[model samples]
Target: MTDSGAVLPWLVIREDDNGNRYRVGRYATRTEAEQVADRLGARAHERLYVVERVDRATA
Candidate 1:
């Protein structure tokens, strides 16, 4: 997890019973989802999200 109003990016990772990995979403800014990942730690699969600034129309 990152500090509030952090400009850093974040990733949301989730695993299923079969041990499949998935990325729920990518955020340009740190959010609650990132915090969840931090708390879950190694128990959860890794999903990386990079911080990128894009035009709203293109994004």
Candidate 2:
């Protein structure tokens, strides 16, 4: 987050079998977020991880 409290553009989200979602982290680029997500996803047995871009206009 910035001083203005703006959220990062890239998000790493984790979802569990129960359909609960959590924000793993935020990044300035999608690639960075995806790398983190992929790393986490590899060790997850029943969970899911995804990377999404947060568009400021729609946010």
Candidate 3:
């Protein structure tokens, strides 16, 4: 769960380089996220992950 208490559908692509995390896109399903991750990971040498994300919002 995120700070906003909402679970997002899917986080498509995430890249971590030098301890910096970058969110690329969000998808409707995990399968879709994984597909994009596979393609991006093949080209990117940095740490990449495709997973679900919880929505976070400042209150």
Choose the strongest candidate by lDDT.
2
Q: Report the lDDT tens digits of candidate 1 across residue range 34-57.
A: 666566654544543222333455
Relative to the true structure, candidate 3 has a C-alpha RMSD (angstroms) of: 5.5
Q: Candidate 3: TM-score?
A: 0.63
Regions more than 4 Å wrong, model 1: 1-8, 35-59
lDDT of 1 at 2: 33
Q: Residue 17's C-alpha lDDT in candidate 3?
A: 81
Candidate number with the higher lDDT (1 or 2): 2
Model 1, residue 12: distance off in Å is 0.4
Candidate 2, pairs of clashing residues: none
- Can you rank all candidates by lDDT, best first? 2, 3, 1
lDDT of 2 by residue, 1-59 (tens): 66779668999999999999998988888888989999999999999999988778865
Give Cα-based local distance difference scores for all models: 0.52, 0.89, 0.68
